[model samples]
Structures are given as C-alpha cells and as structure tokens.
Target: MSTLTFRSVSLRYPPRAARAGVGEKLVLDGIDLQVASHELVAIIGRSGSGKTSLLNLAAGFLEPTAGTITVDGVPIEGPSADRAVVFQDDALYPWLDARDNIALPFKLKGVPLAERRARAEQLLARVGLADAGDRRIWELSGGMRQRVGIARALAAEPRFLLLDEPLGALDALTRTRMQEFLLRIKAESGAGALLITHSIEEALLLGTRIVVLSPNPGRLTAEIEAGFNAEVLNGASVAAVKASPIFKRMHAGLTGLIHASAEEEIAA
Candidate 1:
C-alpha cells in the first residue's frame, strides 16, 4: 500500500553563529505524521515554517535530524525512484523541449531511446502538453513548464509524489486551472501525494486532508478533513464553496490562526 510513517521526526540546522550570530535553528520539532496509501494530504503554513523541510524529509532529499521515516514499511535513507518530487520552479532544462525533459528520467534509468521517446510522448499527452512536446522550455509559459515538470515526475510511475508549492508561482487563473488538472492527474495515476502550499483555497480545493503547521519550530497545529468533490473543484461550484457558511467560518479561523501565530512570533 506504500504507507509513509514519520516517528518523532525532528530537524535542526546547525548554528551559523560565526556568520549570522544566531544560535542553531530548530526547524522541525518532533513531528509525527503518517500518510496512508493513496491519500492526498496538504501541509499549509506561513513562510519560514519549515514546511519545505518536512517535504524534503519525506522525499529523502534530507534526512531527519532524529527519529525515523519509512515508506511502504521500508526505512528511507536517501532519494529513490519510488518517491518523485515536483518543485515550485518547474526546473525544466531550458535547452530541452518538453519531450526531452520528460524523457530524462527514462534516459537515466537506461530505457531504450525509442521507448523513452514513446513514453515521453504519452506523458506529454496525459499532461495536456501533447502539442508542446517539441517546444523548448523557454518557448512555453510558466504554467506550461510546470505541466512538463509534472509529466517528468510521472515518468517514474512513483508511488509517492511530493509537491512543494508547485503552483505558488502561477497567476491566479492559471493556478486554478492547474489545480483542476492536478486533481485529474492524481485520479488517473492513483499516486499518493503530499503537497506543501500556503494557499488555504488551494488546500481546501485539493487536499483529502489538510494539516496546518504552526510557525517558528514548525509543527502540526490542526488537521481538517477535506471532503471536496471533484465536480465542485473543477466547476463554478468554487464560488458556492466560498459562499458557504462553513467555508467562511473555516477560512476565517485558519487565517486568524496564521496571523495570530505570526503576531506571537513578533511578540516573542
């Protein structure tokens, strides 16, 4: 089932006092989270809340300073193909076209050139970039680049997908479109995802469960079940959701919580 487990996890960045005159930073404080198979969980927090660090740990891009993390009952020591990450920057090679970018993973895995090309073409179509396969990254828009990134990530058929603010840089309209596209891709691929984002609207629209992290020594503050319907998320129903009494209440609560935490940090 590819379950992910985090047992009393913590992360500390060593003191850079010689340069910054600050003490060692405690980034994550004893976090314990589990993401079950096929679950799409969103982690939301203000800037500098260590949300990215947490995602890095899950992806094995960074080891936890303490405790253990396991994927599918296997201890994670480093990066592996079983987990794929889609970052905020898209990170596509400027020189490579969409097809070549998507084919990089297969090329690295030593898949035959013809097979890689075929798979890349298929994934580009899947990600709505079928006509963009031959277009270089520079020729594509920001949202299109990210679509290519998503296609590249899918090339591995990863069991776990980690997204770090993958749509944060896009324009509002484009972000909304990408959100619906992501939902469709998730449904089609059936890959479990852990998304780190700051947008409450995005979380509410996309997450199966939303986990909010408190600021400074970031840790889980609240976990809310998100029962967003695919149809509602993809249609004009978003306006209705925003107008719903429950939505207004929760949005106010979360926004207040975020600001209150920031104020507390300032006061401290």
Candidate 2:
C-alpha cells in the first residue's frame, strides 16, 4: 500500500509590509500525518486552524516552510496527477458536457480521443451519473455537479484524494446521502483520502481516523480511530451506524475537544 507522509511540517507566511513590527504568521506547526492507500483520514478543527492549509500542502499547491511531505518516501515538489483534489465548488467547465469534462485530464495527458471518451463513460457510471454524461454543467444540480467533479478527479488515477469540504455546499439531505456515497467511492476507488471538514459528525461518520488540529498555529492535538466508514462498507446503513452509542459518544467527545480548544484560544 502507498503512504502519504507529512513529517514535522510547518507553514509560515511572511508578515505583510503593512503590518509593521509584526513577525511572520505561522499557519501550521510540527504536523506529522500519514494516509495510506484505502484509508480515509478526516481532519477537523475550528476556523483558522489551518485545515485547508494542510490539504493544500498535500496537494502541493503550497509548500511548507519547514520539514517535508512525501508519497512513499519521495518528496513532493508540486501538484501532480498522483494526487487529485476535489473542492467545495465543482469547478466544472460550463462550456463542456460532463463526459468531456471528465475526459479533460486524459486529454491533457495526450490520450487518444476514443480512449478518453471510453474511460470517461466508465467513470460516469462509477459515480452513478451514467445517463448524465451529456448533461450541461449548468443544468445539473449541486450534488450532480460535485459527482462529476469527483469523477474528473478519479480520472487522474491518483494515489490520494484531497477533499476540501466537498459536501459543505450541499443541502442537509443531499449532504447526508453524499456522505454514504463518499464512503462507497473511497472503497471502490481504493484511494487514500485526506478530508478537511468543519463537521464533527462528518469526521466521525467517514474517517477511518479523525485528526484534530488546534488553532493559532495549527498543531495536531488529537487522533481518534473510528470504524463507522468500515461499517458502512460492510453493508451497515449510515443511519444505523450513526445512531449507535459509540458513534454518539465519539461525536460528543470530538465536539467537546474542538470547543475546548476554541475556548482556550479565546481565554488566552
């Protein structure tokens, strides 16, 4: 199995000239994390906790100020097809239909037209959008659009998925359904995932391991092992798994942990 590792990683942005006498702002500090193939690691924390920063580092969109990030021991230099990212906004091209959008990655790689088209069709089916391949991006619902985005990401055949609040934009009912869909896709695709979310319930429901980051220079503060995702994959209903006592307890504990961190930050 492949492993994505962040070793003592930290990020600091230079102080703006306008902020006279202010030192550099530290965003993340001493972060050590690993996401292995087929494992979903969910990251949860309050705003300003650098959850998105962590995801960006993994995506190679931003470099850390210290330490290193690697996939199977090779240092990451910049964004590559090996790590696919799905954002809250679908980011689909309005000019292209769903199928063509998914095929865009392959097209970039110089894959022939016929091959890319065939592969795009397969991904459409995988994401349960088999008949929506011809649909216009503007015509699809928010959930449908996100599915297309995910399919496009999978087109890269990446080793890891960096999901940045992919479901945060959806309505309550759709978000609930998408949670189950995500678990299924994670299992079927066999790609490790690093999900940055604000929802404690989401972290508990989907994560094989939930990691918490404390703010004001985000640091890994807690890690909790969870099996709810595996339970769903094993044929248990999402509702059933969520309603269990252990699930509720963990959710409460995580909520308290995050709230306490926020309170402590305020008191300081």
Candidate 3:
C-alpha cells in the first residue's frame, strides 16, 4: 500500500523577535492530505505559503505542532529508507562523481561497490545521463546535477518520493525536459510523489491532483483534479493536452483561486 496520510496537521514556530510579545507563528493548520500508490500530488502556492514546510514535515525533518502523519497507518517518527527527498539545490556530495553520488546510499547500506555501481549506471541511463556518470559534481550543469540527485533518490528504492521544487532551478528548456523525465520516472517507480512547486503549469502537468495553499499559516484553499498527468503517462501529447478546453478551464479556475487567496491575505 503506497499510502501517506496527514490528518489535521499543523506547524507553529516560536516567536523569534525579542519583545514582539506574540504567540507562536503558525505556518500550517489543520492540513489533511493523502497520497496513494502511483499518485502524484502537487502542492502550489506563493512564497512563504509553507509549501516546503509540508514537504519537510513529510520528510521528518520537522515535527508538527499538532496532528499526525502516517504511512500505511504507521505514524511517521523519523526519516526512513522507504521515503526519499529531492531538494531544489540538488544536494549531491561535491567530492563525488555522478555514478558514486547516485550509489552513495547503497554504499552506506553495505552494498558491494560493483553492485552499487551497476545500479547507479542503470539509474543514470534512466535519467538521460548515461554518458555523464563519470563527471564530478562540479563538472555538470545545474540540470545535470538535479538529474544526478534524482538518480540518487531512486537508489534508495523509496516507496514515496518527496520533491521540493525539483525542477525550479533549471533553464526553461531543461525544466521542460525534466518534467517529462519526472513523469517517466514516476511511472516506472510506481511510488507516491508529493512535489512542491511555484509553477502552476508544472503542478497541473505533473500532478494527478493539485493542492493549493494560502499564505500566512498556510491552509488548503482548493483541491483540483488534474488528470493530464495520466494522459501524459498514456502517451498523450502533453502540449496538445495542455491546450485542450478542460486544461484551460482548470487552469483558469485555479489561477482565480490563488488570486482570491492572495487578496484575502492582503485584506486581512
């Protein structure tokens, strides 16, 4: 069962300003979300909307102030091998080459060098970096580094993949290619993916469901069903599908929701 559930989860940060004389700063409130096997849930919002916070909570990097998150009914106490995270910075070891970086997790697990190398090679090919495996971290481009990061995450063989703006740092063309790569990887891995992104188009294209959050103590503002991800997985032309009427409709509606939420924040 590829199930991840967050029930009424909330996060609050202690007041940092001296003499501010305020209560805790709430970042997330009453969040209820679920991701199932073969599902991609995209989280989108403006800056400071706690998009990354939700991902961090899921990764066990931070504990919520209240509520619970479970994986297949088991409470999440800390990071586990069954869950892997890909950050926006492509957090690879600077000293390691691409192949070694991808295999690092395996090596830590006591996997023989040969077996880890073989698996890393396969993952490299999967991410379109077949020939770049020998390149050191510094030798690759930003997009290439992120590709290696993805390969490394897959090395862990995680059942759930948590991504925080995984493609946000790439150039437009590279980002587009990586989106396709992401879709293919998700299909092949059959893992539940929760991606936090700023680009609404990216969210709509990559997610079977899109969850929008409001600013300042982020809360779920809207939940949209976007099946274009399924279409892309089924070999449908992504560009053509994006241009379809339903896509346009949902995009317009979501944009409106985001704007309304922003306006609400301003008015408050």
Cα RMSD to the true fold for all candidates = 2.5, 1.6, 1.9
TM of each candidate vs. truth: 0.92, 0.96, 0.95
Q: Candidate 1 residues 1-268, lDDT tens each?
A: 6788888988877624465536778888888888875678999999889999999999898878788999877899898877889999988888888899999999999999999999999999999888888997899998998899988998988888888899999999898789888878877787888999999888877888888888789888788887673546456466576677777787787788778778878998
On TM-score, the leading prediction is: 2
* Residue pair clashes in candidate 3: none
Candidate 3 root-mean-square deviation in Å: 1.9
List where candidate 1 sits over 4 angstroms from the true fold.
Answer: 15-22, 229-236
Which 10 residues in a row give candidate 2 its minimum summed lDDT? 13-22
Clashing residue pairs in candidate 1 are: none
**lDDT (Cα, tens digit) per residue for candidate 2, span 1-268:** 8999999999886525357536778999999999999789999999999999999999999998889999999999999998999998988999999999999999999999999999999999999999998999999999999999999999999999999999999999999899999889988888999999999999999999999999998999999999999888889988898899999999999999998888889999
Please give the distance, in angstroms, between residue 23's alpha carbon in candidate 2 and its true position after superposition. Answer: 6.0
Tell me the tens digit of each residue's lDDT in model 3 across 1-268: 5799999999887525354536668899999999997789999999989999899999998888889999999999888877899989998998889999999989989999999999999999998899998998999998899889988998999989999999999999889878888999988898899999999989999998999999898999999888898888788877788799988888888889999999999999
**Residue 120 in model 1: lDDT:** 99
Better of 1 and 2 by TM-score: 2
Best by lDDT: 2
Give lDDT: candidate 3, residue 40. 93
